[model samples]
Target: MRPARTTVATAVAAVAALTAVTGCADKTDAASGGKGGPAVHVTAKDDSCAVSTASFAAGHVQLAVENQGSRVTEVELLFPDGRIATERENLGPGTRATVTAEVKAGTYNIACIPGMKGQGIRKKVTVTGGTAERRDPAKDAAVDAYRAYAQAQADATLPKVKTFTDAVRAGDIPAARKAFAPSRVGWERTEPVAESFGDIDPKTDTRADGLEDGQKWTGWHALEKQLWQDKKLSADSKALADQLDKDLADWQQRVGRAEITPTSMANGAKELLDEVATNKITGEEDRYSHTDLSDFQANVDGAQKAYELLKPVARKNDPALSAELDKQFAAIDTLLAKYHDSHSSDGFVAYTKVAPAQRKQLSDGVNALAEPLSKLAAAVVK
Candidate 1:
């Protein structure tokens, strides 16, 4: 089934912000690090994907991919030389596979397709010096920090999702619409990827009527039409609403009642990270109009709050994990600072500074962090 779009959107935005600060790094200077063999680890889910490093060395590369989403996911590895080193298809949820390929270094892209065209995750990795380094403590800490930030963010906003879903279930369209912005703020940073839906205008789309016109509706406009414009609602609309409520309820129950163990926190982090990564790579826009970078900034703020609440428990359970979590927070701070500087008050103002190709490069650069961040979350909980 299609997962909750609003939650995914908020998560994507938060992820993007986090990536902007902590995940985005230049790895062209390969000689600075110690000599090591080349290896890459990747994780894939219905909503996202992750990679081990943004840069790597050329040679024999081993890519480990894991699917964490509820639906089937696929991952493909591409080389700058225009070659597909490996393609893993139909990797069901909670399953993983490894692929070995001879990579010639330079740069590469990893694409994960969870749904629709352009509705997939893509990341760029650099292969420098012909070798890769094993996991470093600092790198590990950064990953943990990112995971902790994501988990905290999700925890804070999940209640808002429940509220929205409840209003929808009660047929309170106005309430549901009102609740949309607060809930969607969590994933607003990754608007570029979230807006890629062909049938929807991520800027002003919505999904008011469930399964109507067979048009694959999306965004706030679609939602507005469904709630205020559409004169018709299929029998499935009620059912969909019911399902939506149930999904939100389930999420609330799981998140609220579930023990705040490392595993659970890690799982939550994984989900958020996946959403973020997917949006970064896929550029699927949200269905809500207000779901923008500012909204995402709010989500990041919420995540910070959540992290504070869970900090003690996270540290008590794993000190190393806690330290890592701090790194992610720092990274996020850096990213937001940079993003704010680049965008000014408007969204993506830096877009005008770069060539079209460079803009694409920026997008690609953002995608590279998806898998690594997700894996870092997994490591914390695992």
Candidate 2:
């Protein structure tokens, strides 16, 4: 799910005002330290976003985020136009997570969203003092390849979504039911990219609970409820189906233009694992249809695909991390395979049937993988 965003005009105006503050443009203090560069420390509380320093030297910067808030919070490093450079979400109260993002010498924001909704509390930051990086040719190749992969995933999703939507338009409950989980596989695989487009994800994937005050509930989950829980099509079903197709088509066309870098790929992989743990494993994502396992597997597949692409760099930089990641990923895969269902169209038993103990195991496996996966961004950019 997409978190609430800062508006472009608001962000731009804030950035402009912050640009005039000489203190924000000053060099980072030595007390703000990290291994290879200054790591910006962010303390996200219920009402404020606090940063250790307003500026840092350009390169790979680590954000060590701690949520001191009562509500679950998220911290993001956003570009001036509100595109995510890198972000860590679903951070429960008092929990800590690290996000590493590649930043050039420029202005950016450190946004803390308490409750993971509404216009977030924003702080302007200056990424100061660095010349253009002479990036490794191999890393450039990885970015290109990942871009192709994202585009391919979008291409594959369109027709599958069409099948589902077509079934919806025709009032074929059984066909829509069968097509629902299958249609979402490709989207789940590259969700971070789709999410980067901002408006598209909310329209196509937001859950009933994730909606804003005035936002309409559409997308796969909304349709899923109609087909499974309500057991009949509503008058709005066809219009909603058409809207899904159009929103997705917009994603397919715009995905090629998404801002993808090696660090973003590595970070996106970690985000996928988080998606599984926070949403899919809890069975909240597919509560109506009980197809959470299908999403579970797809998220793992996406994360693995990213790891595979970045493996050469990560292996070279930190071979031990590479080894640990490989072992943990296999563990997750093995655990998930226990739920495979040959009879199901999506190849997994209904998530509703998973026992509490079994769900805890899945959650544990995801956390194990997440720790190492979180290190991937820092490793790749090194």
Candidate 3:
């Protein structure tokens, strides 16, 4: 007979994996603020979970869990003494739930079901004394602003994606390229948020997949390579674009079904930022060699997922900020087009060979975008 899917043994092992990585910088710092606390925020994803800050004292605390993925999942906060302080069950995608628990300052484990077993994604938050800092009204406003922008950006890009995918399917390179520009813009406006994690060299990093080994056929590099390097269209490219379109549609549907709350969007953004940092800091390019690209793809995937969840709330909450985000998203599209047209395969080869010092400058430029983007996001929640 097949093994039981949710057996105690399986759950124990999964919980253990979460415990190992729980103390890593990702979730803990987010919840504890790297200090003692009362207000804690936790973000949950497919294979892992993260807290907004770290190190808290034992007391009454409000713990918020933001579900950024599509599927329903649970997040459980386990104490060192083998007690469950809090457990949130069946949290729908793009939604959030909160629990106020009396937690002692110590180590704790946070885990997701199925995928991240034995990976040690748990976090340790120390609770000491004093009430948690009151939420900043200004920062809260900024968060709301950026959330609006991000949602508008997503909405604007949908039509462009449809056109681009259709053009690719029709074997119209120029048209497809034109369509691709807008999608790239969506990414660019958000690039600052993407950059905060650090530098990512698509060429040298084996983790970048399709760009590194020449097998995978999706994402920015994949589409860019087809337009320039291969100079030939294939059925797979169209198929991949179609998949993206479907994903976007699903995201739209989910957004419509849920209520967009400030807590949910803020929690989602915090989680995405941590995921990006985790991928940039700890991901090994060579580990993904057998597959295609680095976990950078996963990193971006999470950001996109979080945006989808926050988009509706943003649009409903702040229309003007949403418009501004759309404009920036469009600007990003133009930049990618210029970069792709100039670089090609030959350009990528040469660009990748630049001195490390020069590369650092480029990396700095890319990563620096995160600050402004983060500011924008923070503006939304404010």
Candidate 2: segments with Cα more than 4 A from true spot: 2-35
- Top candidate (TM-score): 2
Better of 2 and 3 by lDDT: 2
| Candidate 3 overall lDDT versus native | 0.44
Which scores higher on TM-score, 2 or 3? 2
Worst 10 residues of 1 by lDDT: 26-35
- Alpha carbon lDDT of each predicted model: 0.45, 0.82, 0.44
Question: Whose lDDT is greatest here?
Answer: 2
Cα RMSD (Å) per model?
A: 13.6, 8.1, 14.0
Question: Against the hidden reference, what TM-scores do the models get?
Answer: 0.38, 0.90, 0.40
Instruction: Tell me the TM-score of model 1.
Output: 0.38
For candidate 2, write residues 204-284 as lDDT tens digits. Answer: 988787888998999998999999999999999999999999999999999988989888999899889777766676566
Tens digits of per-residue lDDT, candidate 1, 1-382, equal 1222235554454334434433322111121221234446677766667887898666545566666777556566665543345454444456554444445557778888763224378888887666453444543554455445444544565577567656666777767666665655533421211222212222223333223334454333344345544534344555555454444333333332222323223323333334433332233333333233334344345444444455555565567766766766556555545445442433432323335464344344334433333333323321
Q: Ten residues in a row with the worst lDDT in model 2?
A: 17-26
